[model samples]
Target chain A: MSLARLSRSQQSNRLPELLVPAALGTLMLIYFAVPFVAFLTRAGTTNIITGLSTPEAQVAIRNSLLTAPISTLIATAFGVPLAYVLARASFVGKRLVEALVILPLIVPPVVGGAMILTAVGRFTPIGSAAATLGISLTDSLIGVILAQTFVAAPFVIITARAGFGAIDERLEQASRSLGYGPLSTFWNVSLPLARGAIIAGIILTFARAIGEFGATMMVAYNPRTMPTRIWVDFIAGGMDAIVPVALALLGITLAVLTAVQRFGRVPTVIDR
Target chain B: MILELKQLTHRYGDELAVDDVSFELEEGELLALLGPSGCGKTTIVQAIAGHVQPTAGRVVLRNRDVTEASPEDRHVGIVFQQPTLYPHMTVSENVAYGLTARGVEPNQRDERVSEYLELVDLTEQWDAYPSELSGGQQRRVEVARALAPQPDVLLLDEPLSALDRQLRERLRKEIARIQTETGVTTLFVTHDQQEAMALADRLIVMNDGRVSGSGTPRALYGSPPTPFVASFLGRSNTFPATVVAQQPPTLRVGTHKLTVSNQELSVSAGTSVTCHIRPDGLSVIAPGSENGTALSLAGEVVTVTDVGRRYDVTIRTERSDEFVVETVERPPEPGEEITLELPRDRITIFETHDHDRGSTTGVPEH
Candidate 1:
């Protein structure tokens, strides 16, 4: 037989073994792609232009852009130290704290929002105390931030912790022996060594904040961030109104996620 | 004392890691803490570095009590076994780290970095990252980094232990030269007896979390006080013997009268004492030469192997004692008659009553 025919027969013989996994993998890919492609095709450049002019679409996109980053900043402030502790410290109750940290990631977003409202809603003790201090979480931007941060903070903490954990402790000790105090060593050695992981964590936090929908809806429906605004428009205009907003959300998030993936990859400064 | 570890004691959980280890180092002295692994030599070094706080002791450097001082506050430069160079930084950056931490001006930092890089013979590797350098070059960078700080005291924690034989020898010599040039008081800890002997002006031999012996390396090699020190420092032949005579200048072992040259120590006659004779102290005499062989014993040649430039000839004596002799000329063939002459002057006598000397009949403790 000719070589080409022999190779073709051999490939055909191997195809039976690969068919199950290939079919399953293709099914998954199609499931993931159908909605995204549909949104893109339905919401053309013309549709986006017209959608941007509408007051609801304009307000909601701006609202999501503004609120998501604020939530990311808040998560960073709380998660950085928590990541360090998780990465470095050995203490009692560490596993419990770890379980608590991972809890928000596993719990349904709606439930996480409900839990936040129960703890800090308008009628709750903390909510009343916050009201006295000119802080209203429920039905406000603060409420939206609280919801987003609750869902997003864990992403930063876990990623940053892994980064810090990979660092060699001897380097820190070397810094200390070289005349840098504990905090200075943290700034000079620990932070710089783990900056990649921390940045990656921050990127994940930002993405999670922007995508947060159920939690945002449960707590701050009036503030109508991008996801909630899309839901409201869908209720009024069905799939016709929903496509443009979905596409807008998908476009911005895809852009940021792409940037985040590139930014989050730990740079190889030493090797090449 | 330029640096003093006074009664330093440390415990890891319930187990004692270092026990009442005390030593004083003069200015510019290079002292080595030498021991086998898990012998607490590292514990003593870390205790002095303030990495591990001793349960009961004082660490005084330059007459200042620094038991409570943090490692950074102690102003001690340390080179670890792993060569802990920051992989993210360039060689020059690693060398400049200490000065930068102390907020040295950029101009002086550059000068000091160049000077130390030159000292370690890595002037060309300054711009290269640690991952790009060879292992030996990385270690040199670590050495330069430690020396750049110019701290009051320097600590080398098995710095050359992880290296190959050639690199270890080179760095050992380099460390000695650098310490002399900088005149920095240093504590070099190592498990290798040869390394300690080559680099240390003074050596502290440790075992089981306690000081087994301490002295100049030559003195320790020639006359290690305990069986532990004798074997740890050199290949000394130690055996249990009853002191037949204890004259100021005479020590008779078995039927042969061995002359004691030092004439300072006088142990009691008839007392049980362990006799140690260093291998180098034993001279090989040609048969029928008439020159005195003080405590001579005839034996059969076991083996003779050439090592480097010299031949290591092993002779199994009539008394079953083995001497690893380093000689220039070719030695007798195996199974041939031979005589090893243990000189009169080179011997250590220690009296012991412990039952740990389990092999009581002509016992040689390990």
Candidate 2:
């Protein structure tokens, strides 16, 4: 009658079998935790405040907040619909479309930037058309947005696709039968059901956009975002300038990551 | 009067899921599509509700063709076996989903939602989320939600099949009461024969994507069209019988000469037929007491089982036909000789050609 008997004894008796794996995992956890702790501690009273007060650091922080989230939002607006389609619709070339969407994540980020340049750069056909409309892709805000979206859209698409796929098809059918139309059903039922997954995807996209380095450097080296500025400071000013900014970025990332982990606890459904 | 399906045929790839199933549902009638799995009962309901496309058919509501219409356009309510209540919504909101989707003003929606909650006897749980309610409560909520809009047609796919036996029986009664009060046309589907018989006014027996028969539960049970309905509705002791002597309501089968009505049979004398006698209709009496008037057979009781309210007695007759009888009173002990009196009117005879055509054997031994 006691349901706890099997799992409790199984875990305890199998402790030796799991020892090496557990220790290795714990070791990795500590290895990562140590640096983060040391960084936060060093920035506790001295370097952290000083790092925040720097003028160049302020601009980098401002640009980082502005461009990364904007691109992330753009990606979300575009990516979520595609994710829903991929998860639900059965059309020809779907697998190919999915492969193409996530292809940027696997290719090197610098190469991704270069590919964007060839396609959308001012001198190329699409870029020339844009230039004809007086828009620029090199060393510009638009270039940064493009680069960030290119690098980070895949994260959102992958996660959103999973989230949408995880929902029961019957739920949507029920919604429709209950008199909700196609769009309203999606807004009221489908969207709310997949909320946690959508939030998780947004957080992942945000993180990728914020941490973007190679593509940012390749496309828009000037009008420096935090990552680009960090690269610049690391090369020119060494650890003195780069360390504090890195710590601040780590703190912000940790806060967002914690929020995501706490609120984005979606139950994994096998059928979906 | 409320719902009609005309030549509704649906196909899934190469196989037909629902084959030319046509039936009309009267208002306030709980019509049960009773069959085993993959028998097209669910497909018929889905087609009527506009959830599935019929390859060749027309679904009519109030004499209007709605076969090509969307589910929303059809305005039919549906309840899945698993309660498809919106988990994020409160009970009231869940019940009001159909109305709210149609842009009903908040005040009217709230009143209707409260009315449905009270009708389902879950008024106190209106504020509760779907996850907070028990399985039975959730199913009731699903029922309430489907009924709130006062849709003409209500489709239920084994709504109570997920509950325990006791709860299922209890809820089945509740559904019958609610359907009576609401006066809506309901198409209920279930593999459970008892559930079908208890709830259905008219039972549509389906098998292999086609309708086997459609009539009142008593009509289907008392004088089933084929051997399938005879055994499906209840227990039947089938024996290979030939018409040694034939009359209007009685047939003589070999030397045993068991009495069976020819109303369900379409065969002539000297033709082999399958005779089915209901276990409850068979009575045990002393041999030769029938005095040539009743069809009596001398048999020995092979097995006697106490089936709660009655004793299930299986008698092996000398003609090799095993007669099963159920009686509340004392039954003959095993190996005891007894005469099973088969009344002339209680037996049904079907042509041997239709015997065992759709009756599935090898159901897991209980």
Candidate 3:
């Protein structure tokens, strides 16, 4: 037999041994992907395009695009420092705080929404205080942003913390010895070294924010995002409206997922 | 003139990494802090560089106390054991990192980078990333980076330890040459005694978080104050000697009466002592030769192997004491009875009770 044929036969023999798990994994992928496939197949691209431009759909799209990023930014402002501290510093209750941050990720989105509502709902103590200050959290755009951030911040923290932790402590010490001050060393050495992981974390955080559905539904039903819009179209316009919105949402998420996968690959610096 | 550590004591969670150690560096002199790992050599260098704050001490730079100053404010440059070049930058950019941080004029930064790269003989690798360079080439870039800053003092933390033997030797010589040419007060830390001897004008020997001895490399090697210094600085054959007679400037050793000229010592007669003599100072003689082998001791050659230009011979005496002897001619055959002669003046004497004698008993001066 030719070398190609021999290798192919060899591969074919080994393929059965791997086939069980590989097929199962592919089935798992299909299980999650079939809904998107069906949504796309059931509606034309023009339908999706038109569905996204509808006034209600447009408001949902605008609110999602606007609120998710603001949530991510808010998360970053508090999360980056928190991640650094968790990675580098020793303090009381640090583990507790870290666990608390990851809690939202583990809790169901509806439960997370309920918790937010109980704490900041109009009748609760904090909500009463917020009401005194003329600020509303429940059934508002601000509430949606807060819920997305609450769910999203932990992913950034976990990824950024691991990135910071992976860096050799000696690099910072070396920078300091080379006459760079602590702040300069952090900016020049630590930040650049952790850049890839931080970008990955930001992307992950943004994706989590954009995909947030149940919490947004419960906390801010009035302000509909794409996920909320799809829910509404399913209730109001049946499969005709729902399929197109679902397709649009699926396309946006997939595009974001692909971009994140491309950008989040930690670039190996040649010198290191 | 450049830097000095005064009563430096560095404590890390109650464990003293560096005890009360004090030393000074001249403007252009190369000082090597030589010791095995965990001997507090790095702590001293870090303290002087202002990376570690001594629990109590003064780091005097140009006669000014900079003990509390940060590394940047101290104006000291350091080369870590690993090549810590910025991975994103090329060799030239890595070399210019310090200058760039200092906001040096762009032209000057370029000039300084080129100058240091040339000094390190790495100008050809200027555009190469650190990952693309060989281990030796990367270290050269690290040295170049440290030098480009034009700092008052340079601290090197085992800079050549990562390189292979030939590369380490070559780079060490190159470093000594560069230090001499630049006249930057340099403090280098290394475990290799040969490297310290080859590079430093003065050697600071550390042990267990304390300075054991500090002197010119010649002085420390030639006349080690302590047995640890005598043995650690090089190799020296030490013997158990009794001070049967203590003449004004000399003392006798062993059944064979050998005298060492050490007048300042107040060692009395009949006191037990340890006598050390370097290998080069000892000669293998015929059973009874001229001068009658005055300090001769009988031993059997345990191992004899030719080491290029000379023969590396180990001789074990009746007491199972092994002494390494390097001789130009062929060494005595193994199991052969041999008489080793030690010259009187070259012999070193230490008090038997001296704790440092423990370190030299198993080792002989090279």
lDDT of each: 0.82, 0.82, 0.79
TM-score winner among the candidates?
2
| Sequence-dependent TM-score of model 3 | 0.87
lDDT by residue (A176-260, candidate 3, tens digit) is: 7666888788788887777777777877788889878888877888778888888888888788877666666656766766676
Sorted on TM-score, best first, the list reads 2, 3, 1
Off by over 4 Å in 3: A1-46, A91-93, A177-179, A232-241, A254-272, B123-128, B245-254, B267-270, B290-293, B352-366
The candidate, 2 or 3, that scores higher on DockQ is 2
Q: Name model 2 segments beyond 4 Å from true.
A: A1-22, A38-55, A255-272, B243-252, B256-265, B268-271, B352-356, B360-366
Model 1 lDDT tens row, B1-366: 789888988898899888888899999999999888898987777777777788899999999999999989887888889757887789999999999888789999999999999988889987999999988888888888988988888889888878889988987888889889889999999988888998999999888888888999988888776677777775656655666566554555556666666634456777767777766576666656536647776777798887767676778776676666667776677777877777667777767643222221212212
lDDT (tens digit, per residue) of candidate 3 on B26-131: 8898999988788888888888887677899899999889988887887788888876877878999888888877778998888888889999888888888899
What's the distance in Å from true for residue B344, model 2? Answer: 2.7
Off by over 4 Å in 1: A1-46, A234-240, A257-272, B87-89, B121-128, B245-272, B283-293, B301-328, B353-366
Q: What's the TM-score of candidate 3 when only chain A is evaluated?
A: 0.82
Candidate number that wins on TM-score, 1 or 3: 3
Candidate 2 residues A33-96, lDDT tens each? 9987886665555466777678988988888888888999999999988899999998889879
Query: Which residue pairs overlap in candidate 3's backbone?
Result: B235-B364, B235-B365, B235-B366, B236-B364, B236-B365
For model 2, what is the alpha-carbon lDDT of residue A131? 82
Evaluated at residue A2, the lDDT of candidate 2 is 48
